[model samples]
Target chain A: MDYFIELFFSGLTRGSIYALIALGYTMVYGIIGLINFAHGEIYMIGAFTALIVSTVLTIYGFPLLAVIVLTALAAVIWAASYGYTIERLAYRPLRSAPRLSPLISAIGMSIFLQNYVLLAQTSDFQPFPALIPEFDFMEPYAHIVGSSDLAILVVSAIVMILLTFMIKFTRTGKAMRATAQDRKMAMLVGINVDNVISITFITGSALAAIGGLLIASHIGQINFYIGFIAGIKAFTAAVLGGIGSIPGAVLGSFILGLTEAFATGYVSSDYEDVFAFSLLVLILIFKPAGLLGKATVEKV
Target chain B: MIFSKRMLSILAAFALAAGIASNASAAETIKIGVAGAHSGDLASYGIPTMKAALLVAQDLNEQGGINGVKVEVLAEDDVCKPEVATNTATKLVSENVNVVIGHICSGATKAALPIYRDANIIVMSPSATNPDLTQSGDYPNFYRTIASDDAQARTLVDFATDTLKVGKIAVIHDKGDYGKGLAEFVKSFLEKDGKAEVVLFEGVTPGAVDYSAVVQKIRRSGADAVIYGGYHPEASKIVSQMRKKRMKTMFLAPDGVKDDTFINVTGKNAEGVYASGPADVSKNPLTKKFRDKFMATEGAEPGAFFDNGVTAALALTNAIAKAGTDSAAIAKVLHTETADTPFGAVKFDETGEPIGIGFVVYQVKDGKFVTVQ
Candidate 1:
């Protein structure tokens, strides 16, 4: 029973990270109808930014709390800027062009950003300093889950709730939804469709940045290539939950994470991906529109 | 446009003479191809070997060259991939390198060996430790300064059973050619030793963000120790996750995990982890000379395979100088003659396994890997 609980929490923690990154993919897909292939690179840049900031601050003898806050702030801001720039430079130009053009551009941007980071920094894995301190009251339960895991879960939950509230009640949120529904109609109604798309990209990049900071700290390492695999996994999660649906992305992430955990725990880590993808295949086969995805009729 | 048979024969003979002339001139500058992953993730391992080869060539040239002929280094990056290794090998061959120093990582070494053999270029690896490279009797030209994974696995299993006295062991691998190969050896050796019962043998996906599930499974298995077969990246992740989960099972791994990067990446979580690596011979004056030289030149401590690299460079140069450019003579010299390196006087056996070079288990204490007694 203890083992099962431990696995459950592990799954939740993993799911939270996936959800954070997948939200970016789903949101960008929702508003702009682009996969935003460079979303993962944004996450990687976030981790690298956090790593650099935290390392420098710690060297200068800053307080742990201040260092953590400053590092996360730096990561989010830098990643959000990169996201905005990428969408503007790569996607905006190809908006009226064929859809495949922007996708190919997105992929080229992904490769370009990866190489850019590689040249600017290094290909080596740098040790990410542990920022999350151990909670005193959680000592007894530390055996089941570390303090970092708890922090990740709580932080992700809060971020998700805040995002939900913003989307449900804010003006910018309504603009985003309107733009997502129909870019032409939103523009016709004076929605400033371009601004909504940029904001969506910024929001999604911020979430991915948060995910990168947490996961890098949790894993205790960061590299230029870390974004590629994380991006692929989160993209899978987004697709599994219906790429354009925000809630579906969250649901798919949890399901995927839990499936990976239980599979690795009960069976073997060798077949962990096998089970996760198999679940995705089964869901796609049965529902054809993902678990929470709504099948829409295309207008002629 | 085609030549007649008589004219072709004459042309072929003239071409052969020209080839012989070029070969003779090539001997004046003995080109040593340093092939390995010099630019990618495994660059840490390969770069040191390349640096060592370059330094050795410099030293030899400084000392009036090898047998009055200047030594040269031609480096080609394979990025530790097998497919690229074949290209690296062919490139080295076309460059007319007299000898090859490395194609680090066992898979790449295995891939490039046949190319070197076909070209009759003796290839010595600084770190490739797969047993089949030597034991398979497929490549007589292949030699390595490091001990094979089979030997490494035995050392690790022996330590786990005899030193640590762990009875139930869980073996895990990254499912790569090197990692899976080492894990299989560990599993078989453990079964044969009969001191430890193999509780769980599994492979984990490399580059997974989290390994908590595997950590949970390890805990539930009740294993006294976990033997891992992979590089530092995955090993650091597993060890960090296990410590975070408060699992006290001993973590043991092979040379792939025996890196300062592992300790750095894992930080405090790296404590008490055991890894088998090339036996330390730092006490040797030759070792000290190279160590100081590397530090002075590179401004950093020589990394994982620096010693092996020194040995390989010394051996190759020593062989070519002693036996001239004849491939057969070079092979015989490598077998019979010894090159005094960081590992003391080093010589290759008939099977191309180095004599005297072996593995030692090191435990991470505080923040560094300390050699275990």
Candidate 2:
């Protein structure tokens, strides 16, 4: 059915955005055991950076391909900077204080960053230019598909694969896993726990920034406070998939996005959010540790 | 050469009394509270509205004040939230303001309506378009420069049926006070006429990035025209997504989607999209000078709601000039008489709705909003 196909494509696109953001939550939670609530703000700032960079590129009349590449690079680099700064300034000092301390600090940083962008930029829903071009292959099926949607799916898939490979094979990835498994033990084994955590933040921030860039291009609208609602949904996805499980986070986002799209398509759009959150509650009741999460024992 | 204690005391008292007399004279100036989302997401609307209020007050003050009272305008940021709106109204009431020009969002206006109603504060909202603002008769002291949401139906129906030749219409709303209210009005308007059948009617959550489901339904229903009842941001997304989905149905919208930002957001896909609003005041002969002054002050081209702001300000100043600062007296004048504005002479109907309303439609052509009707 055309109806089914329509929902599928939209669900995939929406799910990819959620998955990217959820990866940020899962990554930080896995490494530091503290949810980087400000990850959403990093995404927002990244989109802002992309918008500025892309707009300047357009003014300079750069080719579309070069502009897109450079803009993504600029956004990733800037967002990684924000990620590094937030982790160092807000979470690092409070890392050893108490579990609640870093969390509260992350939330405070989220609010602070949101207000900071609000001050720096106009509060209006500024238009984001359409950066991606229509492709020759999808010309006929433009009704059922879009180039941007394809780009979202492909880019997100590649990112996930690369992230998985890095986690599996790379040295820093090994250090990250060691740190996440046991920070004290990893540090004792000369794994450089703080460096691993910082690397996690940078990588997670880069993923979120790309999510921001892609979604901004798809939606063609950006504002200061989009991060809050998005952050909440991604957090939900992280919990639904399995907190601290990277692959689980992506799966949960896809599920969440599919549920919203199908619910809106078949039942009612009014109850779309209801379905997403309700699914979370039902899943939590059935599996407290989430779909792919393992139950951990407290070490004496 | 120290003065005696009594002399010092007398001098201080004399100075204090003199200051008090001057302050009392200053207090005679009429204060109008322009409450809206001056700081948050809706500042695009509120800032322009507030600028118009400020410009009108400045012009009045320069002319030696209105009715021998200099106009003092204070803008409060309600952040477009209901609770904050009520608080803003209460703050304005405490400041002894007799008139409140805004709280631009319909939800915000609804929240603060009862406060102004009970206190007899005249509120001439610039952009709040919910029919409930005046139709309920719960707030006789409230008025607006823009037409009621119901007027949007009246604005779009004729254009949709005759001009666009849309037979089956699909009406979609964002489920907000303004958006849903306008959608209901359009639905009822067409249903009453029995001219065009509404094939698909739906409500959507605003600020959600996806509307593909809604678009697919519209395509399936074979509705020749789709009417969006919401602000430009959501409209832009829906329009862009609809086009991407290859839905060939023509798009028609209420004034909520008339902003230039809509075009920018939708880009090339925005062409041929139709929008309706109550009379383009930009073409009025009186608006040129005002527009020039406004551009100088606001540092950009005026938004769609700019004139709504100026109109609200003019309504207040003219009524206050006639009846002084008593909001009850201003309401009496506002009800019984018409206020001349740059938009034109605006009078209220029995329900305080704007009378002699003229609605027009515009279509986006070559990346510009060109009036078609």
Candidate 3:
């Protein structure tokens, strides 16, 4: 029972991170109808930004709380900017072209960003300083999870709650929903669909940046290629949940994370991904849409 | 038609002149190719070998070169990848390098060896330690200054069973060719020794975001110690995660985890972790000489494979100096003659394994690897 609980929490922690990045993918797909393949690079850039800022701040002997907050702020801003720029430069230009064009551009943008960072910083794995401090209150439960894991869960939950609230209550949220539902109708309704799309990209990128910061600090290292794996997993989560559905993305992420954790725990770690994908294949075969995804009928 | 014929003659004349110029240059200098991961995550391991080759070449040239013929170094980056290594090998061969120093990772070395062998270029590695590289009998021209994984694994198992006295062990690997190969050897050696019972043997997907599930499994298995086989990036992650989870299980690993980067990354979690690396040669005057030279030039202490890099470079040059540019004679000299290296007087056996050079265990103490008695 204790072992089960531990695995459950581990899965939750992993799921929370995947959800953070998956939200980016689902949101971009929701608003612009493009997969934004470079979403993972945004997450990587976020981690790199956090890594640089935190290192310099720590070197200057700042308080841990200050360093953490400022580092996260820098990462979110930089990643969001990169996200905005990618959508503007890569996806926006081809918004009216064939759907495959923007998707290809997204992939090209992903590769371009990866190599850009590789050439700009290094291909080596830079050690990320421990930003989250050990909590004295959590010492008893340390055997099951660490301080960083707890922090990740709490921060992601709060962020998710805020995002949910904004989307449900705010004007921009309505505009985003309207844009996602029918871009032409929304434009006819004076929704300024372009701005809504830009906001969606920025919001998604910011979430991914937060994910990057947490995971990098959690893993204790970052490199140019770290984004690719995390991005792929989160994208899998998005697809598993129904690509354009917000709640579906989160649900898919948690399910994938828990499945991986339990599978690795009970079965063999060798086929961890195998179990995850097999589950995906099984679900897709039955539902055709993701777990929470609405079935869309294409007009013939 | 006459003008076109004259243009053809000019092109042929230029081609012939270029061929003669290249031949004259090839004769004037002995080209040594330094190939390895000068970029990518494993660049730390490969860069030192490149530096070692450069420094050795510099010293040899200053001292009237190899038998009065100047030595030139041609370096290539394999990124420690197998496919890239073949290209690196082909490029070196095309450059007509008389000998090659490295294809650092074992998998890359395995891929690149056929190219070097086909071209009859003797290739020596400072860090590629797969036993199959020597034992497979497929590549006669391959040699390494480091002990093979089997020998290193044996040392680790003996230390765990004899010194640490851990009876139950969990073996983990990154599922790469190198990591899985080393982990398998560790498991078999532990099982054969009968002193320690193998509790769990598993492979983890490299670059997985989290390893908590595996760590929990290790806890549930009730292993007294964990033997990990992989590079520092993954090792640091696992060790740190274990530390975070407050698991104090004894952690032991092979030389792949023995580097300053591991210590730097794992931070406090790195303490008391045992790793078997190339035997300590810090006290050797030759090692001190190279250490000072490297620090003075690069302004940093030599990294993971620096000693073995120096040894491999020294052995290659010494062989070429003794046997001239002939690959067969150089191979024979490498097999028979001893080269004074940082690893002490080193000579390769017929199988291209360094005879006396071996591994010793080191435990991370106060943020550095301290030799274990």
Candidate 4:
């Protein structure tokens, strides 16, 4: 039972990261109806940003928390700019073209960003400073919580709660919902749909940047290709939760995380993905619209 | 008709000049082909091996060239794929390279060997560890500087059973050619002398983040130790997961999981894990010198296979020095000559396998690998 609890906490920690990145995928898909494949690259860029900022700060003997804050700010700003430029340049022109065109362009953007980072960074795994303090909280509660596991869980949970509050209570959040539901209707109703979409991208990108920071902090290193697999898992979480649903992404991320944890704990660790992805396929086959996702009937 | 005659004369004169220049330049420089993963997952290993080879060629050229003939290295990216390696080998043959140095992964090297053999180009690997490369008995020019998986397995089996007194063991592999081969060899060797019992044998996928079920099975199987034959990434995750669950079983691994990346990824969880492979860098004087130099220059420790690459390069340069100008002659000398390398005196048996290569056992202590035996 203690082992199970330990596994649960570990899963939650990983799931939180998946949830954070998944929010970007769900938000962009909600507003633009494009997958925004390059969202992963933005996450990668955010990690690199944090890596550089933290390393520079460390060289000057800055406190850990101060370094973390500076790195997070840098990552958030860079990711937001990257998100804005990608929307303006890559997806905007293809808005009128066939649906496949924007998707292809997003993929091209992703590849372009990956190669660009690879060329710039030399494809090496650069060590990043551990921004968070490594406290041994597990000593007193060894049966229930490990220090590393708790830190990841708490950090992720706080981020998820903040995101939930932002989407539920903010005015821009309402506009995002309005734009996602009916772009044409939202525009006719003076919603300024374009601004709402751009804001949505910025918000999602910022959240992803936070996720990137947490992931780099958790992993204790950064590389050019770290975003690729994490992005896939996050996308899986979004789909599993019911894409376009904010709360759904969080729920889906937890579910995916717990499933992976359980799989790793009970089965071979190698088959963790097989279990999570298989669950996604099974859920899609039966529910077809995800747990919280509404089924849409295409007009024939 | 008069205009056509003038154009034909010009074209004929240009073709003749190109043919003459090509022949003259081809004889002056001997081209050696080096192929490996330059741009994929294994590029970490492949890129450094290529760099070391280049450095060797540079050093050779600076010291009065090879027998007064310039040595040119032509590098091709195999991306660690067998099909790509074969194609690269064919292209190298077409380019008339005197010999070839790589295809670092065992699978890729094996796939490209037939092409190299058919083309009669001597091929040597700095890092391939599969025993089958030379065991097949079909190629005379193929060589590997590193100890084969069989040798590593024997060393690991002996250490786990004799030194650690690990009686019951669980075996896991990544299911790749290298992983599966190492696992089988260790398992077979362990049970061969009726000394060790393998409680569970299974295969796992690579690059996974969790291993709860596998650990649970090992725990239930009543095994006192777990032997993993895979790379550092998976090994790190497995060790971390075990620690997270507080499982106290001893973790053992082969050479592939012996890199510092294991400790980097696993952190404190990596402590006490036993790994058997080549001697630690600090063990030998030559390796110690290289390590100090690498740390001072690169600001990082060299990877586990770095010495193997350097040794391989030295072998090639030594053969070139001994054989004089012709590449085929160098190939002949490589098959017959014995020379000293960083790994000690390097000599290949008739089957092109390195003789008397040694393996060491080590344990992770304080986030660094310390040689235990």
Q: Considering every candidate listed, which one attains the maximal lDDT?
A: 3
Candidates 2 and 3, the one with greater DockQ:
3
Screening candidate 4 with a backbone cut-off below 3 angstroms (N, C-alpha, C), the clashing residue pairs are A264-B212, A264-B213, A265-B212, A265-B213, A266-B213, A267-B213, A269-B210, A269-B211
Candidate 1 DockQ category?
medium
Top candidate on TM-score is 1
lDDT of 3 at B234: 90
Worst 10 residues of 1 chain B by lDDT: B1-10
Error of 4 at B27 (Å): 28
lDDT of 1 by residue, B159-180 (tens): 9999999999999999998899
Residue B201 displacement (Å), model 4: 4.4
RMSD of each: 6.8, 9.5, 8.8, 9.6
Error (Å) of candidate 3 at residue A63 is 3.0
| Residues forming the 10-long window of minimal summed lDDT in candidate 4 chain A | A141-150
Off by over 4 Å in 4: A1-7, A140-145, B1-146, B199-205, B208-224, B240-250, B260-274, B279-355, B363-370
Q: How do the predictions measure up, each by TM-score? A: 0.77, 0.75, 0.76, 0.69
Best by DockQ: 1
Residue pair clashes in candidate 3: none
**Residue clash pairs of candidate 1:** none
lDDT per residue for candidate 3 within A152-201, as digits (tens), equals 88877787778878888999999988887888999998989889988998
What's model 4's TM-score? 0.69
i-RMS for every candidate: 1.0, 1.5, 0.8, 4.2
lDDT of 3 at A58: 89
Better of 3 and 4 by TM-score: 3
DockQ of each candidate relative to the true complex = 0.60, 0.40, 0.56, 0.13
Question: How well does candidate 4 score on lDDT at residue B113?
Answer: 93
Q: Tens digit of lDDT per residue, candidate 4, span B221-319?
A: 788898898877667767765776577889989878888777775777889999987654456665565556566667886764677776777777788
